[model samples]
Target: MTGQKPVTIVAIGTLDTKLVEYLYLRSQILEADPSINVILIDAGRAAIQHEAITVSQPEVLKASSASDGSLESLPRGEVVATMIDGAKRVIGDLVNEGKVHGVIALGGSGGTSIAAATMRELPLTLPKLIVSTVASGDTSSYVAESDITMMYSVVDIAGLNDVLRAVITNAAVAIAGMARGYAVRCATPTGSEVRKKCVAVTMFGVTTPAVTVARQRLEEMGFEVYVFHATGAGGRSMERLLREGRLDGVLDLTTTELADELVGGVMSANEERLTIAAKTGVPQIVSVGALDMVNFGPKDTVPEKFRDRKFFEHNPSVTLMRTTSNECRELGKRIASRLRANCVDASAIEVWLPLKGISAIAVQGQAFYDNEADGALFDAIKAGLDGSGIAVKEVDADINDPKWAESIARRLVELVNSKSKG
Candidate 1:
């Protein structure tokens, strides 16, 4: 271990409720590896016995100036939000400054929320672990796009029981091993040096043909193409990369996530789906690929009102619902409006429409074919851009047509090249 670097792990929690548990976790981490150093940060909202605190409450509170006076004086929601901001700043600074090697946290829902917020601020490859009572259930909100490992805490974190001791000890050992073995840092700093230009593309099962061709063309043009799966989480990942300056341009071919968001569906993305591309001014080519249907879980999960509407069983676990003309109109207006507002710094923005069809299932004889809905979408987008400077183009071929995909690929390459020259 002579050449090995020192390993430091950050233990985060609301120390007021779980002080004894955290202390045990810290001890176990040191016991696991003699070389591991531990820092106990107090993220508790309520006033606690400060004698046992490592990173004092006042220091943590200073990270976020947005918070009001006393932590207890504000409402519960405000407290959680403020602490999240503060924790993110503290943890992010530690990683950037190269003071912390890994992060581990133990909490229930509220505590997990605080720790998760901070962990997300770190990069994708960092070793971040969370032992939570809510880990066994839906953890989408907790571990959005980060590489945080969630270990189910069979017993509550209120106190130390025989069951909790083993769980906490195992989590401590896991983080210790990870910290000792692997060191994570930002491999490619944005704009640090010249490298391959990255293009972000969106794809779905039905629109795979378009994205496949586009990806090949972009790669052949000496660019790196990253295809995102158009699921709610996938869109969020793309947005994060855009914010981080990891992408050079965007080929937004599949806007199906918007339909899911507008309707109540399992794959729905948040309202901020397209805002990042707009605000970042990344040269983006938009399309209505796969916008013909909204995604839902099983057939039984489809809502009561939508039961009468057209439904296609994509698979045993997935159901697809066709969008009505009225719904398509709303989606078109929303996409155009967002682009109009956020594309100020963009060098160019174009909306491509596939007149023949938007997806495999939306063709002439396909189950999801609905010309009225598709037309409404197309017209609404054009109407929304009436005064806006963004250009709209229509192609005679279907969305999956080889020619259609090639055109989109060429358009993105042209925009990227033009931006570089300018």
Candidate 2:
């Protein structure tokens, strides 16, 4: 039941058992927004004894299967993996074919898993709603870095009832309202202006001075700069954006995440952090922005093994630990090796070293002063890059100095333009 077919409201669930529930939802959504188009997607293999749109599961499977028809031929465990992959492909094809605008799915644990998997594959702008028993517990896993709204079914969806129907209707109508009233037009319009190149910068409070200086310098050079705090989430999101091809170049100054990664700290980035620059092969300028600190929770919560380490009270709740010489050596080698992986892009990268201190406190007269430790870090950077031809410079100024920041930005602009032209 549709009027203008402005949006395709997707009703997805286990059509074998929850067909009635999903069909009711489709009817309710259409009733709420007459202009909306309701498209039923049955991901389940078995059919239910009810009204439904019967696109064969085999057709959906074909859309996601590999060459030689091997994707559908996997074992049950592998099938579950492939089904999630298959659902994502089916939903994506539906979206591309202009058949679905908003998606609504209801399921128990297994169904919830598939629904969430599909919803996640859909972009952030698309409205997604899931009604599941899984929503009652920790939803972090189900909604990992996604925007799908989930509602817990108070009763199991054994069959549609007065209560269950009411819940489904609410979700359907809410989705309809979200879809019809405030339709999310994709940000990337058909004729919108082209995206400008954006610069990615990494910083912590310790490296704010440098980042601020660098941002201003890069902005003057006609580049958009996005600074990410050197925290776990910050690093992850930046890498995610880089992989999405959203970043033009990187000014990764505060490389403290690598220290935490190797030393076992709270703010440690995953192994993928340092390797991103090499993987993307994009023009990037990197330095030991905040290699001095290993982050932890509140001061009192620091682990027992590193109780004697130099601690800095960055703020009331946050604590920072200076990396040891050995830790610094390992971290430097790890970073150099990662950067060295992209030999083709090596000329596009430069590992600048600040001679004074890596961070504010590590300088000659600061509380965390340790010239030997700083030297160890510098030595690691030198030894790690056994000549991939990646430029490694040793600047005499402190990292926070304005000169240090400007130089990094200038070098990045040079590499970006070089790569852009070639």
Candidate 3:
């Protein structure tokens, strides 16, 4: 498909409320490319409020009803949840059935929520656009872990006036251009025998040496490594690809997000970060890379609850706190449970515990140093994995040491190659 090729440009909105805006978009798309295919999808629950536009029902029907009653009568939260689920199901069906090439929507709060849910179900590469009034606020909820683009509707989605008309027209043209441009570049990949196997790696600033070294080694060994920053979204996206079955393997170096899980830090990947490789059954290499400290924001951003914890400043923007022995115990327990659950024969998966120190700053007399704290973490892992069959090779080197990095890279290569042979 190319810009010159006929493409599906979805014209979606409450044809009931903004049939004018929807029609205007259809005109803009036609003006851009007369050979384009425009799809009118009715996602609205109620009958369109305007004169009957003879709109047809969607191929995938999504019923958005809340007891067929007034807002006061229905539970608002339940209504939104129901609509979100229906929209996602319908959109998934459309994409799976090869119906929609590109998607465009103009909506308010309800539209933003519903339309975003639908777009979120589509893959990251697809062309998605939303001309929304609520694009101004915390769109994190609607855009969570997806690549849906949003444009602010300066004027409301009510009856279109001069300002409304300009915004809507520009949005439509932008979406049309996206569709055409994407279509133009839609040729199938060639058999160049150069399929770059993508591997996802997690890293934080504290664990720079290990991540930097491992990335270089992996690339040298003919693998493309994607380094995720271990922030809330970064870890979430790493797990998302793991579930989507996109990774050849995973090197979960900086488990700092696990810190956020143990402590109440801002960049919490929670329990999900530790188990992605296990769930996906990928060639996974786990490490206690940056578990020495939990992540937080500015000094004051440290929750009042954790104000008494020992803190170190990575920079003015980043604050780090050493984990307590008790916290380390829980973290080890959590990690062990994941390893045990993902236990496999042939010993492909392993966790390397750098006994000297886990992070650059955790070595003797460094900012995060506390042998007692380190001892607690080590003991917890030993006790938790008493007989789980998960290998725990304790090295006498600090985590950033050359030997530790080499071991990790060497073992991962062996595991991946073993799987390749099998």
Q: lDDT winner among the candidates?
A: 1
Report the C-alpha lDDT of model 2 over 212-322, residue by residue, as the tens digit: 999999999989998988887678767777777878899989888888788888777687786766677888888987887788879998989989889988887888888
TM-score of 3: 0.86
Per-residue error (Å), model 2, residue 180:
6.6
Error of 3 at 27 (Å): 3.4
lDDT of each: 0.87, 0.79, 0.75
Query: Which 10-residue window of candidate 2 scores lowest in summed lDDT?
Result: 181-190
What are the clash counts of all predictions, listed in order?
A: 0, 2, 4
Against the correct fold, how does model 2 do in TM-score?
Answer: 0.77
Candidate number with greatest TM-score: 1
| Residue ranges of candidate 2 with Cα displaced over 4 Å | 1-5, 9-32, 43-82, 96-112, 120-194, 298-304, 313-318, 360-369
Residue 226 lDDT (model 2): 89
User: Model 3: runs farther than 4 Å from truth?
Assistant: 1-5, 49-76, 161-170, 184-186, 192-194, 344-346
Which order, best to worst by lDDT?
A: 1, 2, 3
**Alpha-carbon shift of residue 251 in model 3 (angstroms):** 0.3
**lDDT tens digits, residues 1-422, model 1?**
45555788998888878899998998899899877778788888865665546686666777877676468678888888888887888878888887787899999999999999899889876789999999999999899967789999998898898999999999999998888666533322366766899999999999998899999999999999999999888888888999898898999999899999998778877888888877877889999989999999889988898889999999999999999999999999999888888877634788999999999999999999999999999999999887787889999989999989998899989988887787
Residue 419 lDDT in model 2? 89
Model 1 spans > 4 angstroms off: 1-5, 46-53, 66-69, 72-79, 145-147, 159-166, 177-194, 345-347
Instruction: Judge candidate 3 against the unseen true structure and give its global Cα lDDT, from 0 to 1.
Output: 0.75
Candidate 2 local lDDT, residue 250: 94
